[model samples]
Target chain A: MAAAQDTGGEAAAGKWYTAAKATYTTLIDTGHAISSAYQLVNVPSGVWIDERGRIVRPSETAAPKNQELKIGGKTINTQGDAYVAALRDWVAKGESSEFVMSDAEYRRRVKERSPREREADACFKLAVALHDRGREDEARQWWLRAQTLSPDNWNYHRQDWSFTSEAGKKWMDKFQKTTTDYYPKLELKEKP
Target chain B: MVNRRLLLFGGATALTGAPQARATVLYGDREVELTTSRVEKGDLWIPFGDLPGINEFSIKPQGACRADICIPLPKELKRKGWLNLSGFARKVKQAVVNDGALWSFGEIPTLRGGFPESRLAPDFAVKDRKGDTVRLTDFRGRKILLLTWASW
Candidate 1:
């Protein structure tokens, strides 16, 4: 399944959905509620669900195939191939899949919301609500609070920054200097 | 022109008593433009009797309660014979993000922890291109690679 964390509904997100030629269901999240519900802080995030509708894997940075970039004399590879291979293996093996995280591991990886983080989600929802009503000045203030409360969430930054003139520049600056790793290194393990 | 004419354009005031407030209230994840409210000493007050229609926090003998959850309204909140919704929210530990006029209330204090222990994904509904409501639970009994992307 595919979902857009875009707040503009069809006008902003529809073209991408069309261009992707997605065979799966593509949803438009105007309120960003889906991400909030999953406690996801960034896009290109994925969650794996099993036949019983239980989360086998929690939300994490997901890049399909491979992403190899040469920058500043360093090759940055986001092991998307390994993730995809693990996913395929899960499809083949179901519960017995070595790709599936054990209960202990799952608990370790799953984001348990902090009180402040929970408040941040609420603030985010309110910001969207204010923005929808054309009260953008108020919306910006609330969004900033949300960002401050949970600085790791790039979705909050991107959503708010899109309204500014230097969106791409702002994004690059933040991405370069922000304390959090661009993509947190996944330690997907196999049962030994 | 007509100097004596009282021009009320939406919420704006031509003849000043005090500028009419254009307050947008976000309660229980729902947003609505408050139809009736007042400002006192820079604090906005919604009438005690009008709470139900405004944001579903009705006035009860026990205090302001929504279903089982109730916050005892302090006497200060009852100043000028009106309910201080923001005051009540603050007392209850529910966040209220504001910018003078727009007051957006956060989650119910009891509902702010996180996802359930079952690890089942929280279901949500959104419209597809076909304008039909699509729910996450609809795709149950199958493996799902739920991915989120954005145009920006």
Candidate 2:
């Protein structure tokens, strides 16, 4: 998924897809709809679904390759190898995969969407609609409202700040001031 | 343009029992205007008759409903052929934002009745990099590693 503002005609996304020689379809999300739909807090998240469309594994930080990045003196946990290995295991073993989360475990891991978060979603989507109609100021207003309602949603903050001229400073300031992992640490292990 | 007017909500109610020609409804990504328009008491009153078109809700014998989920509205709310959309939304815990003539509604909470038990990876449709529409259901027969990424 190309999760960002519906701009640039997704040229960068297209270029990256070509350079990587990727075969999978890359869908563009302008309104952060996928984030809202899947209850994702940030990008590079993944959800594993079975052939029957049931979510075998809930949404979690998904990085395909191991890489450590130093940002605002914090390390983004990219559990690439273990995650990918587990994914491959699922592909090979199907429902018998030890990595596949059981329904009980899935229930425990996935949190229910709060009403405030729902409202935040509304605001975020409204911002997208206004932006589509060339109403930048109104869009910004709703985007800020969305972030305010769901402060933990880094995608809301990151996406909003990325549009401004002082994006780096804004992000660093917020990053340093806040106390939360860029991506929540996932326990990558076989389901017992 | 002579009769078209913009109605905004700012705390106080503004019900004119008026047919607001410019009133627009944005539900999710689609701005659906497939039905007649009416604004009442600072709320976008989606008439009971127009519910199916606006939000897929239909006035059934039990109540206003979509699929099997029904929200039984109060008598006062279902008046003058229009359902008190604000009241109904509040009852359903649907987030609503009225910006001038535009009203944006969030996902109706009723649809997500059961939590993890009903956790089907929602089927979503969006434009592929090639400008063609793609959907998650398109890959139903295969295992999907649905990942969200960005160039940012």
Candidate 3:
């Protein structure tokens, strides 16, 4: 098993990595590069790769258990223990793993981005370049632009929110605006 | 046109004394001095922490993004916290070259080919807790579960 952090510096990532105590390969991606590569827009996403280097499963929310949490008085869906159980099944069963998605299903699930998403990506890159130069104001401009381009990408908003003190208020406002459909329902086929 | 060229050429020389000019980056007529960390495969690598502007587009899931624009990059180009300038330039269709001390990027290209489709996961290298380099290929023969999560 391999784990990578999305945002935050090494210090922040280290704090959790040290606590996990997992014997797997733990990595810190300060730049969020893994998020981009794996098409993960949020945290706790997972990809399953078989022994032949083929991606049996694409990025999806992977939770070990179901937990009920109230945020802003709203109940957020965190049900995915089935995914965890499926993972265990895959580890033991290989190709015959019931959790292994078919190639056609994988292709269908991996949605393609629109042209606007591509443009937002470019703007975000430019924004990062400017921000690194200690040009916060300029960076904010691009950040705003990026938000406008990819409104659904919570990471972009959350990462920027981390820089400001009003992150909680801002996130609450955003969260309130989201509908109940915000979290995609987990779809797992029953074991045959 | 002449004034722009002068701005480009003059800025290059005037920046010689700036400490950040240790690694010069030229993008079109705008040349900026950036403190670069390392050079790999002849391309300059910019640390993500040092370049916050990249956050606008350096998302892994959506590819490099900027102001509502995103271009899927070959998964092979990503290396931990650093973005390969050459690989990025190629994905965005920009020309980038390293001349020993400086890195120059030409005009941004209009045409872009999205990331290539492949059944195999792109190989990348990252550092472990012990600071030892770990490559994806190291687990070539093993079934690996690559998971991404964060404390926040």
The candidate scoring highest on lDDT is: 2
True-vs-predicted CA distance for residue B33, candidate 2, Å: 2.2
Give the true-structure RMSD of model 2: 5.1
- Across all candidates, the chain A TM-score values are 0.93, 0.91, 0.88
Off by over 4 Å in 3: A1-7, A128-133, A190-192, B1-117, B130-132
Calculate model 3's interface RMSD in Å: 5.9
Q: Of models 2 and 3, which has the larger lDDT? A: 2
Q: Kindly report which residue pairs in candidate 1 clash with one another.
A: none
Residues B21-126, candidate 2, lDDT per residue (tens digit)? 7667777556776346676667677656767766888987688878877778777676556678877888888999966667788888667655567878876767
Q: Of the pair 1 and 2, which is ahead by TM-score?
A: 2
Q: Which stretches of candidate 2 lie over 4 Å from their true place?
A: A1-12, A190-192, B1-15
Q: How would you encode candidate 2's per-residue C-alpha lDDT over A1-192 as one tens digit per residue? A: 344333334764667677877776777777666777788887789988889988888888899877788886788768788888999999999988888786777788887788899999888878777777888888899889999999988788877776688878877888888887877777766456
**Against the hidden reference, what TM-scores do the models get?**
0.75, 0.89, 0.65
The lDDT of model 2 is 0.76
Q: Which residue pairs overlap in candidate 2's backbone?
A: B14-B42, B15-B41
After superposition, the stretches of candidate 1 with alpha carbons farther than 4 Å from their true spots are A71-76, A190-192, B1-29, B32-93, B108-116
Scored against the true structure, residue A142 in model 2 reaches a CA lDDT of: 88
User: DockQ-based ranking, best first?
Assistant: 2, 1, 3
